[model samples]
Target: MSDEDEGPLVKKSRIFYGSLEEKERERLSRETAGTGKLKDGVKAGIAAGNINISSGESMDLEERVSERQSEVLAEFERRRRARQITVSTDDAEVKACLRALGEPIIIFGEGPAERRERLRNILSVVGPDALKKSKKDDDKSKRSQEERQETWYHEGPNTLKEARLWLAKYSLPRAMKRLEAARAHKEIPESTRTVKQQELHKNLRNLNNFCSQIGDDRPISFCQFSPNSKMLVTASWSGLCKLWSIPDCTLVRTLRGHSTNVGAISFHPQATLSLEDSDVNMVSCAVDGSVKLWSMDSDEPVADIEGHSARVARVTWHPSGRFLGTTCYDDSWRLWDLEAQEEILHQEGHSKGVHDLHFHPDGSLAGTGGLDSFGRIWDLRTGRCVMFLEGHLKEIYSINFSPNGFNVATGSGDNTVKVWDLRRRRCIYTIPAHQNLVSSVCFQPTDGHFLVSGAYDNTAKVWTHPGWSPLKTLAGHEGKVMGVDMSPDGQLIATCSYDRTFKLWMSE
Candidate 1:
């Protein structure tokens, strides 16, 4: 072949010039001082280390770098696609995939899927970390969405709204009165207060010794000191109410008519002090569903309040001593007129048997607790439920309206005593007061600051209000303490237990 027609690789000098377009070759030749020998110019420049490559060479270098980057990106995408699976992939299948990827089929004591996840994580670490982070974010978002969907809300009844409003109205003034009284008590000279307390404590210490008398054949359900603190009224599960003289502990009279266990007994607010012994001095409720009123001298009940269909659990005389309130296993609490011998109102709000009842010191409101773990305060004048005591998770066996009027204490089967503030409409305090069900709670009638509670845990506890601190824990009972009562003078605490014994704890 002719040299002029030789291939580009063979005729290097000519091909170098031939590869350039005519204008580009001219520009190169001009730049190289009109030397048309492109190959010689390149050789000389290389020897001098000043070779000036054209812009086309720079463009080729960039293209090669981009191609390498694209190849790396394509490999990464392939690995990602291999790691991913559709929702149809089973856990067993995932384990198989991990095994095929040279990972453990299972970890120590872990199932196949977890092992597969561990293997997948090992592989992901070899790749970009962003992929794993994105996967975690996606999982968290899905879990959060599921939790939100599972949440629910329920609508309460209109009666609950009305009850809330009533509580606001009924408790506000009562709360104000209590706060005022507390402020007044705070103004008493500290030295004088200390002296009074010391004297009270001396009196309490003097009552350190005790004597026991067999008052009944069966267990005593309750025992209360009269308002005058001179007489003791003891009710037994054998359905007998016996009046005894205090200090001496001598039986004075036996009032008997109930054929079943007597569950509760309470004296008239003025009984034995202002009221004559010949008048109706006490009331007792029994399992036979009868509430009987008795005079101090009578062997038979002076009057019978007989409207309940099931067992009567507790009876209370209103603070005014004119009306009677009784709780029954019939799931109702009724208010009775003592002189009229008639039921004036039958309150049916609790879903379970009413266990205990108490009237507020003002005689305007009453609180009832039941086996349903709920208690309600009813405004007697308006015949409306003022507030609901709603935090207990087990049966409430006893409830007491604090003499302060706005605070109510409830003892529950959950072994807790919760103090509810009617004014704040919330539970203000909870005392894990016992190891078993708390059966009864009573605020000191005169102090309005201290409380007494008895429990199936075989103990009675004295609690102070405002902060609801436990002041004392009495642990002498051999069996469950079923009832507790505070003297009107706040000097003595009486408790009855399932062990068929009555105890007097004097707290000056």
Candidate 2:
């Protein structure tokens, strides 16, 4: 073409090197000895688009090309939505979905094929339930196999039925009262709530080292604040269970029950407050494979409930104050009838040692966590498995139920605190809580506003929930913090540390 027709700025293209027999441009353009020739249409398209083509070819070029073609087809199929999934052509579900998508359900002179294709495209954008149904249908066989393998079959003693009914009867009234109290609490004036919350925050921030006493010769493993928050009960590796007056550090009583290290200790919900001192006011479990009941006035155990063949790791009181749930290294947790003084249920489900357990605030459900890196929630009334908490990557060490009735908190050796929602049936929040394993966790008693977690990192931390934000860190321990508890009165924080002492906290 003439320069005048080509554009005023046109210039001659440059060559790669001095012109020779085998020029770079010539070698690139001409076919070499043996190579896969491009298809005529591909060559035409490449020339039309001014695409670059290299001279050499791979030895496995055909295999690679086939693989690439298959991948392209698979991706196309994955993205395609030409056919709709509908159980019935005239079903109202499909019609409702179509209407919601603002699509025409029927077109003039359209057969079922066209209508279905239109619905498919529309549902791809709007998310029809039938799409889920179709995916589930494809997975139905795999799911059935899993269901068959996951069948949990266990039969307790014949008295299990009576125990379940009794639990139902005892827990129903408490559950009702708790719900009513929660409703009333929510209905309170915003001003009243603010004032109460401010008071609590002030008290919590004022929590400081009140007193530290050497109650045990060995490291303390567990510590609990009484229901009245007037005293503290601490168990140690020396096999001693000691009760000391709060703030004063005065030893009130020493109950020498276990011959080995005490692993768990808990007071009855009514202990030292309403129940008589002669009643079985406290329970403790030890590494000696025995659980013992104690009274306020006795230096010896009031009763011995012996059935475990391995170490008893944890003891938890039911909200009804009539049942006790204990975890053992025997790969099981058992429920004890405190009134009848007998073992009511011997439940075994964990693959490894059961380490910790807690009853739901309403007492109708119980949760257990263990060395298996998972936790299970059980229906107390029917003994059926309710939910599985499976996100912890290491052994679960502590569990606590929130007063709100739907949330559970678990501390694990993975150094994380996970909060689960029973209603959502999933882990709702995971707090990267400690540098080492988390050892214990507890939620505030009445309002369930805050959770306290202790860890082997030599720290105890408080976290506020719903958002799960760290509130404060209590870092005075000289060694690993083993146990933590929040008082029902919201006035005390107790922690047992491997430093061989239990510290008390109060505002200023």
Candidate 3:
């Protein structure tokens, strides 16, 4: 009985052990499933590939974007090049090309390069059919610019163009005559020319020793040589205009009407040469706001022209000697009929006080400059501003018309002297002339080749035109040089300084 019971117990024990092993296997399978699910969740949250903590993937993305941009730029360049065209190298071809491109066919200022460029642009846009029609409009614009640049605009009464033509015709023969005379003069022996020049230089050097008589109680502002070059007219800060004998420097007569500084003194073109001394020989303007006409023989003014509300700085005689142009501190310049002594035109355009005025040799144009740092050319006959001289960085103190009448020289507070071509209507040269403000500039009347400038730096400079080179620097003035002038013969240069002296310089 004990053996049978033990056998049953052992069988039961074996079954129970087997059941425990199966339960253990099932628990291990469930744990393995949970761990695999957790691993799958972590992989989904992190990413598809290995995480690049050093930003290598970001650099790869940037490189891809850069490659795309380069392709776009290359395509743009190809399109631009496809639209480009070439212009001809020849003149006629250039003109034809311009015509075809709808640009001007004839040229006033169009150079071959400019015409070519214009043609190229036109061909690029509309092709070549527009070039012939281009000339008429281009000519009109060119003429307008020329008129504006020369400051000779005129709303003519129809006869003015005819008058201009007549004058041009008249000038051609006169210029030819002058050229013939020059050629004849050039034909003279070089030794004789040298001797004449030497003699002129001797006279100029002798002129350096002139007596300085006190003309007024205050500083003298300006002095002018009489038309005959025998007498001198001086204006002073004391508001007096005095006539004096040359070389001797003896005061002859004093014209006193202005109450402030006398800024300008201009002699009539015919005064002391063809006009009588008793006639109105000089015109003077002053800071007292008045312009006075004076006779050489009298101490009183012959006529008073009073319209300016502020100081009148400079007065210029028209080549006709029939009109007077005066610049004033009121930011306006006026043209007056001298014989009638009435204002013919009130020109107001400057932004600051007008300091200097000059009439072109032809008498058809007048230039006005002031503290506005710009200059204006006005057509005297037509009463219109034709050109504005713009470019200076500071106030312009003086303006002078070249003897050729197409060039202008201006002295400015920027310490430079600028040479402007009225024909080109642009600044052709800039002379770094002085260390301080340039007070005056004057072109020689006889020879258009030379110019003179005075500066507040206590120096006077002799300059050659066209090239605008400094020929000489005259440094003797003890104080600021106020004015400079060249003799009609181009032999001597005279400079007045604030140190109460005037010095004459000659080419050594």
TM-score winner: 2
Instruction: Write candidate 1's Cα lDDT for 147-201 as tens digits.
Output: 7633232443444345435445665576578779888988999999778765644
Off by over 4 Å in 1: 1-183, 189-209
Residue pairs of candidate 2 with colliding backbone atoms: none
Candidates in order have lDDT scores of: 0.76, 0.83, 0.73
Order the candidates by TM-score, highest first: 2, 1, 3
Weakest 10 consecutive residues, lDDT, candidate 2?
12-21
Pick out the ten consecutive residues of candidate 3 with the lowest summed lDDT: 151-160
Candidate 2 stretches with Cα past 4 Å from truth are 1-151, 189-199
Comparison by TM-score, 1 against 3, better one: 1
